[model samples]
Target: MGVPLLAIVAWSGTGKTTLLQQVIPLLKARGIRTGLIKHTHHQMDIDTPGKDSYLLRKAGADQVIVASHQRWALMCETPDKPLDLADLAARMDYSALDLVLVEGFKDEPVAKIALWRRGVKGEVADLLDEHVIALVSDENLTIDLPLLDINQPVKIADFIENWLR
Candidate 1:
């Protein structure tokens, strides 16, 4: 079967990463292998400066693979093209993962759980989109969608597991 994908979407400083940090371990406890994709608007470099791999990339190599006994990484320069969610997902090795959790790319047409708080600047009026399957929030609300307490990662994980099934 194809790997299940979900997005945890929220505005900046709304604890999206914090919630994922909690949820990932909970999912692992339940024997679910998870893969993650984090989208950033700013330019980023994974290679260390002055390193051979970094120098190779600096010398105009399109891609560079750095390997060690413990870990390996592939750094590709994509200056002209901007990848969307599907493009980024395709690059992942999903053979060993049960699910892929994406953070950001809120506009992508994927199933998502929105983390909402009252004071957050980007709070939505209602999460009525077809892609928005659930809501996790700090304060209880009278919304029609399925709501889970923001602090309870186990319950949230359960909700995700059920939805995936």
Candidate 2:
């Protein structure tokens, strides 16, 4: 693998983003340069409507890249077909990252960790899938694979660190 990838899959209100927000900084403290890819089902627009970049894109520009001192963004109009996870991950700067944390895209055939909280969605039955390598949950239940605590980001970070090794 060019860059190690892990998918954080969960139910709608399962605190997937919350746990990751806490976990990412801990990984950074451990000298891990992480990259992220988030999948959203909604109609996406990262640019403002009246901005020059947005205006240009509206004017039928197939692809537009806006650059500045701090950062740059690539805006491409691809409504013909949906994007692929592997293809999107391949587009990243592989040499600069130790891991890529993907949020959502549970249906994709990738190594994943299912996140769950006890009271959030009643139970963990719906979150389990074929690709799950581990289960992160609040309540302990019998399972064959590794089970990590949902409340402990440090433990989760440790688990991820071990996985990276």
Candidate 3:
């Protein structure tokens, strides 16, 4: 079976990362092996400057695999073309994970729980999208979808677990 994927989407500074930091451990405590994918618009480089891996990449290597006993990482340079959500997910090793929690890619047609704050202006209209299965917010919204408390990670994890099942 394909791994279940869910996106935790919100506007910047709306506590998406903070919620994940709490939710992941809670999920792990319940024996759910989770994978994560974080999307960013800013230019990012995982390889350190002047490092062998960095030098290799600078030398026109399209992909670099750095390995050691503890952990390994694959850094691919995509200068011209940006990959879509499916492409990114396909690259993840899903055999050991029960779920893949995706962060960002708000427009992707995937099941998601959107975090909304009262003062923060986000894509609130996204909550109406079919892909948004649930809404997590501080205020009590009267939407037709399932509403979750923003401060309670455990409860949110419960909702996610039930959804995964």
Candidate 4:
């Protein structure tokens, strides 16, 4: 079976990535092996123009794996079609991870922790839905779900650990 997948979701400029930068290390310190899948709408390239992998890919290589002692990366060309979340997630090495953290895909029907800032775009927590397991914010609301403090990454890590169990 696949490992448990948790999504950290928020609107642009809401600090989804920033919070994850904090939470991931804490999870590691607690001995939790983690994997991450980040979603972005814009086209991105991890290889540089003059790099050998970049040259090989430009020469019509559909996929290429660059391996070294420290690390390895697989680059696949997918210009014609966009892969869905399930397809993308299947690429992960599940045996090496206890959990997978997703950075976006807010509209997907997955268990997610929604983050909101008090004076940001929305006047209310519009992201809350049946799929949301928790809400993290600087401001507290009278909602039924668990409300976590946005500034406290340790407590958020604690909440995630509790959820895992």
Candidate 5:
């Protein structure tokens, strides 16, 4: 692979976003480029109402893409068909990026760092099986993997560094 990819997974409210918010800047400080793919359970609109892109889509454009100096947005019309996460990942700028840290897609067959909190009542990381190669937790996990403290961003970065190497 041209660029390394990692999936950070956790149950709702397990602090996955909080963890990423810290880790991403830390990785960037180390001269590593990072791309993020976040999955949401609700409908999303990259283009807002009254915008030209949104208006085009309202007028029955299957896909409307608006590009600017800093960023670009694409709104595709798919009322019934959902695009797979892997396909979305492929569309990213992975060739020029160093790492793609994906959030969610717990059921997808991708390498993952599973996050868990003790007494919080959630499914085991083991439920993900072999795809989950490491654990970040606040409780003692019986699984045979490298366990790191939930707040230890450096250690977590070190694990990614070592694992990618």
Candidate 6:
């Protein structure tokens, strides 16, 4: 199992999901199997009300897992509870994945690439205070870590691979 994981963190509206949408495919093209975990500040539900899975949860099940021939999903009924990222990682099939690209969890200890956009900001936030090993931005930054062009996914992927390896 060669599962290398990292977080792509940014403030709200920084295009974190868009960046992942671009990077994941490039990583896959390079033969990296990617997995992702996105942290949200609000309550979220993958299953809707009155659905079978939702009913199972409403009936007091702590967790409900649904599977098909092609894919599987689990909805855990813990709207107010926080999840442990490490435990979640451990539970995943890392044996088949090459990289786990987590989106958010800005305060987590995981190594991350801070995403920033210039020309449209107030004081830049301190992502470096977290475990940010690199910066991904559209303009020049004064951070101590290596900085990569936000549009260059291949270079970023190489940096990540080298850092993990």
Poorest 10 consecutive residues of model 6 by lDDT?
A: 119-128
Cα lDDT tens digits, model 5, 24-117, are 8888888778888898888788888897888888999998889999998666787888758767777787766888899988888888999988
Where model 5 places Cα greater than 4 Å from the true spot, the runs are 125-127
- Sort order, TM-score high to low: 3, 4, 1, 2, 5, 6
Error of 2 at 16 (Å): 1.1
* Winner by TM-score: 3
- Residue 84, model 6: Cα distance from true site in angstroms: 1.5
- Relative to the unseen true structure, what is the C-alpha lDDT of residue 28 in candidate 5, on a scale of 0 to 100? 84
**Which residue window of length 10 is worst by lDDT in model 5?**
119-128
- What TM-score does candidate 3 get on C-alpha atoms? 0.95
lDDT of 1 by residue, 25-134 (tens): 99999988998999888889998899889899999999898999998888888888877778777777888888999998787889999888888787565434678889
In order of appearance, the predictions have TM-scores of 0.93, 0.93, 0.95, 0.94, 0.90, 0.88
Model 3 ranges off by over 4 Å = none
Clash-forming residue pairs, model 4 = none
Q: Indicate the residue-level lDDT of 2 in model 6.
A: 45
Candidate 2 has a TM-score of 0.93
CA error at residue 5 for candidate 2, angstroms: 0.9
In order, how many clashes per candidate? Answer: 0, 0, 0, 0, 0, 0
Residue 24 of model 5 has an lDDT of: 86
Please, what are the lDDT tens digits per residue for candidate 3 over residues 1-165?
278889999988899999999999999999999999999888899989999999999999999999999989999888788668888888788888999999988888899999999889755775557899999999988988889999989999999999999
TM-score of 4: 0.94
lDDT of 2: 0.89
Query: How much is 111 displaced in model 2, in angstroms?
Result: 0.9
RMSD of 4: 1.3
Best-fitting candidate, scored by lDDT: 3
lDDT of 6 by residue, 1-165 (tens): 247669998877878898888877877887878889888887678888888988888889998898899988987766586788886777678787877888998888888888888654434566666578888888887777899988887888788767766
